[model samples]
Target: MKQTTVSERALVLAPRGRDAMVAAAMLAEGGIEAVVCDSLASLIDGLNAGAGFVLVTEEAVATADLRPLSDWLAGQQEWSDLPFVLLTSRGGGLERNPAAARHLEVLGNVTFLERPFHPTTLISLVRSALRGRRRQYEARARLIELRESETRYATLFQTMDEGFCIIRFVDGPHGPLSDYVHVQANPAYERHAGIPNVVGQYVRQMVPDEADGWVDLYRGVLTSGEPIRFERELIATGRHLELSAFRVEPRERSEVAVVFQDVTERKRAEIALRELNETLERRIEAAVAERQAAAEQLHEAQKLETIGQLTGGVAHDVNNLLTPITGALDLLHRRSADHDPRMARLIDGALQSAERARVLVSRLLGFARRQALETRATDICSLLTGVQDLVTSSIGPSISLRVECSQDLPPALIDPNQLELAILNLSVNARDAMLEGGILTIAASHVRVDALEVSGLAAGDYVRIVVSDTGTGMSAETLARAIEPFYSTKEVGKGTGLGLSMVHGLAGQLGGAFTLTSAPGQGTQASLYLPLAPGVAAANGLSSDSTLMEMEPLNILLADDEQLVRIGTAEMLRELGHVVHEAASGAQALNRLIAGEPIDLLITDYMMPGMNGAALAGRVGEINPDLPVLVITGYAGGDLDIGLPQLTKPFRQADLARSLYRLFHTGETLPTDCA
Candidate 1:
């Protein structure tokens, strides 16, 4: 405890008699605290705990082991150099005594005070040693502060997101400060520059061509001691870098620090946007015109779509009304049977007028695209030739007619009746156009077409039928709306606008196209392009015996929502010698079968109230899979794909006979001879 108190001042070690006590008294009188250590271990312990200087006698360590003291002295801190004042005997200095020299070597920072020396000399040496020890503590404080600052710098340099690098200018063969080498880099250096392991890379080796620009830019910052911020492209790596550079302190080292980010994509988008704006003014007018035209076409298309839907609904109702009228009229005509000549003539006129109504309804159905087209392979040249006489009569005596059909013209896949009607309509229009007497030409030819040549048809063989007349042609405005339903230029009663529309609708329904060309002064030409039928034309092989075949009575169920249609249809069926059971709706029709009624054939109107004909057919399939079902539809029956025979509404007894013959004899389509 005493030695620990004294260790901050001086430690006294003197094994010779009265020496230790004397040195202690001398240091105490000089206002210095001192502790007397009995052995070398105590002195070493005092040195470890804390001490300013050591006062020791040469005799104390002369015969004692000094390795412990030597070991303690060797292990001092960098800022520590413990001072020692040695008390040597007379003539026992380092030059004359080898042991004394060895002691001097082991105990460094020592001052020798010989025996019998003056008290003033001893105090002066001890005070000087204490002053030297105080300076070492100040040095230790400075070293600690320096290390902490370096640690903070290292942490920030490695953790920043911006790519950072330090480059030092180097003299090269080119000139002074011509090149630079990367001395340090952060973790983000590789990401921004796209170059890995770049800490030791030289500018010349990394990008030789770009080295001069980089060196010159950073060199300006280094020389001028001003921070520079700019963006530039690195040619070798193909990167655009937004960079900020500043000269580090002590510019003589010629080092610069840089922080950067990659800006390649942002720069490219900016360039593209600038280029688009430069040319936008030149294209605005044409773009608006095209958009206006598209809007008009779309408006016309939507109008046609709405009209087609309404027409289909109206056609369904009209067909239902026409059914009873035609049936009653035909029944009346047959019952009269020439009882009176005047009565037969009146009935015939009424029948012909009803027939015209039927034709008009069919044309409406065609325009609506709801007509069930019976497409077949027919020779187009023969079809054109067949229509020539009718065309000649319709044109009257003033206009001449010409039919020029090419030889070996291919058969087209189309509904022959619809094609005939379409050609007749075209001839009528031509006749009307040639009021002043002009030539009307109808030409038929086989033409091969690619996809781009036709608007609607794909690349294939087609039969083109062109009808032309030398007459007052239509203007561009009239030609544009020529195919729109209910649009006409003729006096109100002179023409129905649906003629061209029905032809156009038929072409679309049969997968074909109708085109017209006309000018104000020149004659008009109307062309119909029908696709060539696949393979060869199939013959309608109805047996001659089928013509003489008699139809046996069918135990039939007739279902209809309209009472008049059902009553008229049932009477006709009974007149044909078939017993008919009637139902008001599809549900009632289905209930008859479920109730075990004797029903050999089920004939139901396709559109009915509670359940539709297709739904009723599906239900009937579960009850009697083999029952021959005949579907009668006022609406379009083409969508009814249940593999049942269909008879369109307002059909005569002959049409009904033909449909029934097909169901009984063959599931495939039969010839019209059965009718």
Candidate 2:
């Protein structure tokens, strides 16, 4: 293939004189390359070999066929405009000679230099010509880069699935931005829009009926420089287009780039649904009212959730504060037998008061559903016999209490501590209703049920406990909203309204249901249904009065964030015959393990600031998997599922020893040494 590669060489043609040779010598002195040709035909051939610019004598081109030279100039690339220096006789500049004008026409960018001119002048002119040629080459390079970039963009534009176009806002007879023309569109445009060859088509021409709407919509986008997403019906084609558009950069161009998808099928479905909904207006109204009620309930739940967070935090701190007080009082009470009779009585009262504070904290935790449940198979009859005294005291002398339970009923799986709290709450509510006096009867019985027999219960045998009052009964309206959290009929200062809610939550937590039935004249009956258990209750191991059992003392590493809680717990552990080591945080505890410290057991606070007990235990597993880890927490429910045994806080010396017994003794309670 014939080709000409452009270079910075000057071509000279002066067949009749030493002009070509002289010019070549002058250019070489000026650090420019030159090629001299003997004839016009040779000059044309040199031009084919790619010269930056040509210097030809008037005599050389005045007599020869100039067609080839003219043709080469005409065939030059758009970026390339070959500069020429025409050497002529004396006084032959463009203004002085008409023939020079003919040479100017032949060489589009021609310069005239007469004979007998100074060499510097000739060099200066030639240098200027060459400088112009260099810029032309630079422009050519830029054009090549632009073309390659366009090639990549075109590939993506053609293959993209989404319909895309570049439209220019054009002013029409109506005013400014009265029309738009699709200057570019992808191949997929027709598949999506059902309009082929949209390029170079006006918006009005394609969908004249909807042109004004489309124009105004896109006009806003172009003016504000804000991208928009909308769906509009193209009325002409009856197709709905979901489109997103943004103004093209260099905003003066008034062009917008649009990406769109045809959502006609989805639009049709929506329209059909709208038509069908017209027949069910009454049902929809009912649904909306129900949803409003649910929303209100959710709003209340959100408020309670906020309160619950604050309550949980307070409970954690209170439990930590109580840890040392309870520990000191417990140790004092155990050694009280040797003290004076009056001092021993004082110690018993302080210990009892601390127990009351502990129960109060548990009640607050229950309201937030953060209290951990310890469910076991419990004899309903026995549990009621134990709690009757507590309930009787709570209701006062005005309410006469009655209790009944079937002797043959099996044990029900439940948390007796929480159940006791719920019983007190119900009895108190019944007492409030009967200001003068009333009978509060609590009865327990077993019943088998199918799914249809209960609202929320599965088909199974359940132990039902009913607390009925002979006081002024509740209206149906009051009964309906009775169990809702924080909904109270009692006057402002009388009740907290969390009692029934907590009871209901307790039943539900143990795979049971709590329901209330009442009428305006009839007294209220609150029923709690508990799932049946497989066997009799295990003797509870959490009693604080249990004596410490003798076992091998452990090299225990204790980690806690609070200094008081840590010191009190460590003292308890040390008194139980264990060698205690303390760390203020879980990270310190983990570091001890990493340093290969001897540790038989790791007792850590669950809510340490950095590297909590669970994380420390996990890291400890990598070092020594057999090491026994017990997580002790004051905060009950949050990130507590670390798959490790946990002992909650506010424990005495006996309780700490009991948890240790579980670790060292395993699956059996050790008898008190009583030494």
Candidate 3:
């Protein structure tokens, strides 16, 4: 294909009239752009102005010196020869124009034209010369453009922080891996590789081990025609570098260009950023968990507080009903015939149901902190031993119960009854776990704990009691939520799910800690840690103390906000053949005393809307210093902050009778267990 060429600009130097006009007209007709100049001065100016070609008459050359033009043409590069056409006679080619033709052989693509008898010949010569000149001009323009592009690329490569290298291949007869040369290296590459003047050098001498790899890479590209990019660690430079090599095509020479970059800093930055992100994520997750835990604790506390309010009222009302029922039962049993046992059975059934209700309410009150606690230093070993029989009785026949009481177990100050109830609850849970056959182990020991030994436990001596079961165990997820109230593994209606919660609450009330550990197929273990009690003796055995008989009556005053409770309680007192007076509020009860009612005893209900039981007791004591007062309420300590003798709600009639007799008989002295 013949490439179309745009015409070259020509300067027509026609100093003389006829020949100048003829050359300009002929060059123009041949598609050569021609500018006509009328004088030698103008022609010289045009040449100096960088005209592509010159068409000059012989007369103009003879007139002007033309020495400047000769010097300029002599300085032309090998590929740049400004064509100068001379207008002459037919033999003009043979004439030696010394100054004009000087260095013509040294210049490339230079041509000459003889002055013509025919305009066609002149036009043809001018066209040919201009075509050659145009080609030279286009080549020069391309070279300039190439040089400019190379300069721009060089600036980029040298200024960049990354390392860059170009590997060139020399083709050979044997499999294309013969010669490897480092053709070009940017400044960054030179600085990193610690080499200079590396261009056009064999890689074997410049980079020994890298040379073989370069040869292989070049061969691979030559054979497979595939570009490869890879990362490698430069142990010497302590940097990771990425190399990208590809065929610089026309694989006849099997040339490949390689670009390298130092990626060590980027890798380090990535590692650091990942670590930072992980740390931030962990911190955020921990913060969220802490907030959630705090919120759950707050919710639990509020729930317990609400339960306490409900149970306190329930205890008062239940205890009142129990008093009347028991009093009536005691009277009926005393008077009824042995043969007519239907009434007796009826009373017994009602009492049993009432007792069960009382027990349930007591459990509720304990959970809600509405139960009075009598904490005494008691050995956990004896406590565990005492609860063994109860545990065995509660478990299924197929389940086996085992007890291991530590010989030297430390004493823990706790309410024995409450602890027994917790043990029984745990035993029941164990029995339920093993429907077929399993072993339930109850053990007690003295553990000296240090801060380093446990994460959440304090450094001190603790009485450790463990309840382990060989029943089915829970998974990690289930174990995590086992301590939550109302959370249970038992089927609905079989368990209240409050047993363990009650145990936890009682442990907290007794200043102890409770923990459960379980895993799938590993069974479950619950550990209770109670603070060691000082200066207390262990109980002798696991026997309940006999109820006291033969009590003496004393003047008693009882006050309650609820009308039914006051009436029922009063009836019990009168039935017991003791003088009793009733009041609805603390103020009213005080009025009775001030009116010289000769009250020997005072009993007040706690958690009244106004002037609670404890505060009322304090006021009554102020009036009559010798009078002994018993503050009774479902709330463990009542709303009043004052310290006094307290009885938890839902107490049996017998318990009330026993308490009253003990208090009045002891006379003006608070019971040691009341606190």
Q: Pick the candidate with the highest TM-score.
A: 3
TM-score-based ranking, best first?
Answer: 3, 1, 2
lDDT of 2 by residue, 460-548 (tens): 88999999998888987888788776789999998888789788778877889888988776788999999988987755334545577
- Candidate 1 lDDT, tens digit per residue, 296-320? 9899888888888888888888889
Task: In angstroms, give how far residue 133 of model 2 lies from its true place.
Answer: 99
TM-score of candidate 2 against the unseen true structure: 0.55
User: Which is better, 1 or 2, measured by lDDT?
Assistant: 2
Best by lDDT: 2
Q: Each candidate: what lDDT?
A: 0.83, 0.85, 0.71
Per-residue lDDT of model 3, residues 30-70, tens digit only: 77677888876676676666666777666666656656666
| Model 3 CA lDDT for position 343 | 79
